[model samples]
Target chain A: MLSIEHLTLQLPYYTSWWRRRWAEVLSDVSLELHPGEVHAVVGASGAGKSLLAHALLGLLPEPKHQTGRLTFQNRALTAARQRQLRGRELALIPQSLDALDPLVRSQRQVSWAASRAGHARSDAWQAAGQALTHYQLDERGRQAFPHELSGGMARRVLTAMAHVSHAQLIIADEPSVGLDPQQRNRVLDALAALALEGKSVLLITHDLRHALPIAQQVTLMNQGRCIETACASAFRGDGDTLATGYARALWQALPDNHFGVLTTTQAQNVA
Target chain B: MLSAYRLHHAFADQTAVLDNVSLSLEAGEWVGLNGLSGAGKSTLGQLLAGHLTPQAGVIKVDGAAPPRSGLQPVQWLPQSPELSVNPRWRVKRILEEAWTPSTALREAFGIEPGWLNRYPSALSGGELQRVCVLRALAPGVRYLIADEISSMLDPLTQLALWQALRQVADERRLGVLVISHDAALLERLCPRRLTLSEGRLSPPARHGAQSA
Candidate 1:
């Protein structure tokens, strides 16, 4: 089980003059994801959702302030207490693919992840291969460098690495952002498969429609606060379903529709 | 106007990223390029903006061929934000590196006064992206090839950013080509849409459906 009680995070001090003026990043945020279920957090950009993800993985950057409780399977998460749970019990799929070491090969990164959980290198290699195949990655892709892989391929490799770590809880942040519709469905299904096997998932994204079909429950966040939390079924009705209403409101605020169109030559002349 | 004829680019391994791509964008048109990852939508956009050279075709911007290096007549916003701007530089400095001065850039970006001194790390993803759009638009470049600028932002922010881009296109009379897989977003912003398939561009039967 995963539980967070009133968890909060603050940005660290920076030498730059601008960093000092920005407001505290996260404030009094609290939510939870239970075993065998998918709890999705949907919010606008700059709402501190990513920071909350960082806080959960104990990966927040230096000099940040954090309070409240983070517990997995009844054990609290502290810098000291989380040492043993780093890989096996808790794992993170970060936003940037470059988060991995640039010098190391992709396969070695997955193997290293497994060894951190006390597995032998040979066993780790086999397990890594198995995970990669399970994720539908080409067997030969294991030898390729990060620079050689496409964005979607890199995401799959990261998932394979996460699987090798044997994490009880997986947190994926906007895992399908740049992928095509088909790839997005594949990635979402894989994560859903993990939840079916009793592993908890904290799926964070901005599109409620993307998560509504996959998530068992959904939490809508706006401006640093979670304004709504309910089962996906509650939003299934027609004509302004909760999810659609929010989406429409957000879409209407976009600047594209606000401006009138320009003729070809006039627009072209500006260049 | 932007046009490419019989465009082809091959990598060292003899793999073709863009194969004989032929497309054109008239002024005042909002074109959305749709493709699965690695479908080479970005490559075609780069070719139009003179960011990349095609091995076998001709590209023209406003009826003129562009040079390989230096700023071409068309402007380009790259895929990765980290690569789009210098991390160590302050936001103001990056914008200044473009053709515009500080006052004009701030006005176009809706940036509050005195916000330019902050570095990219200090800004949120949305803020950084807004800054990037401003920098790209600052040079007053006419043709814009924006490769998935909204992919990293949340819905609310994406909406805002698209609106800003649409306004720029209208005000500047710029030919804007947005590359993305978000069907809803494309439908909302673009009047003419093309799907990149097997390195070829074609109109989809349905406005925003994924063509197989």
Candidate 2:
């Protein structure tokens, strides 16, 4: 239910204490995310994937200039509107567990999210408990502070917070990083379950394999540029069905595939 | 050879994190260790690298105690490079802390010259990781304890890193202990693969793991 067309962002960088230089952080990126669809944005770290999430959430810092058109439900998405809709219609599943409060309990944190989204305190508490239970967190897990939870348990708590927000669109940035394979799959499966329930999910990550199975469409991003957006099925069987040469090379370089490292001439794109 | 003999470690008020664990790596050997989370793989690696002293065990380099101070022979590269680095320090100072690497080595690791002036917080996670790996490859180091270093990287960046490290390991006879959960990655880079579970090591069951 979101559409971005020719989006570009430039951040001002200080130079010599007297002048400012504009650095292109994102350029000419476009995508269409539909309801009930999980769209994967795959790129190397530092390819501006997180920046894209920030732009959508209206969290980008000041002294930034942009040229873009963001449409949600056929309505123009201004920065003020983005700020207003955040946590109500748009929720972000942050990449770091540090986003959680150290002193507060897990269930309380999740309920706070629900309350911020306009739920009454009593309803929010019940929703938080239900969300945590759906993620398989027992009563003890729900009551534990952030430090007490394991890596996987902490991740499930983040997912639970997003669930209570009841947002129409969710953005998860590198949600599976540092999680073991089993925990990684659990988080990915949870995101897929959200999409199954008709929430639009924007999964931004570097790992394509985990995203491919759950995502119907994939956007390949390079340094400040969107190289190609292709159907997830095109990533299979040597990636010959893929449109961009970079995507094919990336597919071939997978450890389980041909394990081909891009030659130096072509390495500049990913590096 | 770098070896750990009958290592034992346990946190206070808890059961043994490690139990009579022993492992050996000859020069230039590449070994992979995989396990479920909290299964003591990192504990074993830390014990081997001297980051954590096992309550009862001996770690030896060529059958002798390793040097107690200065540049260590075994370097540990953790999963999160950001936490490992000094955020206030510039990349140049960070890389030069242990030793200054040659330009050729920097190129191999894909470290850009412009990054040297930037703080660690300014660089992306992958770039910081490459810098950390290059920094750890000092002339005195002989073995590397790579704990999920490339698990955060994309496949292409992952391949690029292993390729570069392989060249140096071959030249320097560096023994590498790779700790990861990616069975496909373990299978590809290491000929001798072992799984850590319940404070013990065993050969991985080849049929169950998904390919990367």
Candidate 3:
């Protein structure tokens, strides 16, 4: 339902009152997410994964230049269109739990999202409770403030907020970071469940292992370029099916499959 | 050696965060501290780093209290580098404020010379973190407490930083305490590991026998 084509982002650095220089941060990146599929964009930090999310959401920093064709549901996505769809047809599960308002109660936060999605106040409140229940949060959890909840609980609450909005496309940026193993699985499973419900998901993460199980298509990124896009099933056994040497090296370097031989593709690239 | 005995700490609400906790690290040793979130591992690290004073218990390095001023022998690298840096100051000032890093040291950390004139805001999180790590590894430091210092970094940056740290520790015989939740990371870097649960410390399951 979502498609990005040859997206490039550049930030301008002012050298003087009249002089300026631009640095390219993202270049010629393209990907697509179909309805009811989880498309994972896997990359190391600074590979511009978050930048792609921001560019799609029209939240790039000022003095930035972007050129790309972004289409959602066969319609070109302009800045105004992105603003229109945000929080309704398009939602983001941000990387930081700090996205939740510290002063607001959890229930009110989810309800606000429901209200934003065009529900009446009374209906929003009911939908908020249902979302909480669906996410396995108890009544006490609904009443608890952000600071009072644990990290895992806060993550579920964020998911509940997105669920209440009923967005068609959900972009989760490293949602599992800082979470324990069980909690990580829970969050990933929730995203997978959302896909099963006919919502398209863009799962942006650094760990390949976390994305492989639920992701149908994995886009490997390096240095702001989409290095390779492969089926999740292609990541088995020595990674010969993987298109790029870097992708194969990445798979082999996993602790479970590490052969103790380092790939010389790039020292800094191989974490 | 760095050691803590019978450490007891509580928050403003009188909730005990750490109770009777004790641990010790010898020079040139790499030790891992593993725990669930909010398990008081950070509290213990802060106590040892002299950031917090425990209500009871004692922390000593080489049978003496930590120096009160002028280049601490024990340094702490917190989880977020953003909090530790001065936004208004240039990167050069931040690095030289604690100790002057040699050119080789700066080169080893991959800190660009151009970054010296830029503010912390101009650098990425990993770059700022490298500066923080270099600052903590200043000339006189004998013991380093890294509390989730690399949790935010990518695997490449994390490995690069850890390799630099390992080299420095080997050369200086520094005692390093690494706090993290990644068991595989601990297994690769630390020869000894300790698990903290609800204010108690025990030897990790996979790693045998705590050193007395």
Whole-model lDDT per candidate = 0.74, 0.88, 0.85
The candidate scoring highest on lDDT is: 2
Question: Pairing residues by index, what is the TM-score of model 2?
Answer: 0.94
RMSD of each: 6.1, 3.4, 2.7
Clash pairs (backbone) in predicted model 3: A271-B155, A271-B156
Please give, for residues A1-271, the per-residue lDDT of candidate 2 as tens digits.
9999999999876544678888898999999999999999998877889999999989988979989999987898899999999988999998877889999999999999999999999999999999999999999999999997877889899888888888999999898887788889999999999999999999999989888999999999988799899999998887778777788888888888878844642654443
Clashing pairs in 1: A255-B163, A256-B163, A267-B173, A271-B142
**Which candidate wins on DockQ?**
2
Worst 10-residue lDDT window, candidate 1 chain B: B203-212
B43-76 per-residue lDDT for model 1 (tens digits): 8887777767788998887788876556666878
TM-score of every prediction relative to native: 0.88, 0.94, 0.91
The weakest ten consecutive residues by lDDT in model 2 chain B span: B203-212
Ranking by DockQ: 2, 1, 3
The predicted structure with the larger lDDT, 1 or 3, is 3
Worst lDDT 10-window in candidate 3 chain B: B203-212
Docking class of 1: acceptable
Candidate 3 Cα misplacement greater than 4 A, ranges: A16-19, A255-271, B205-212
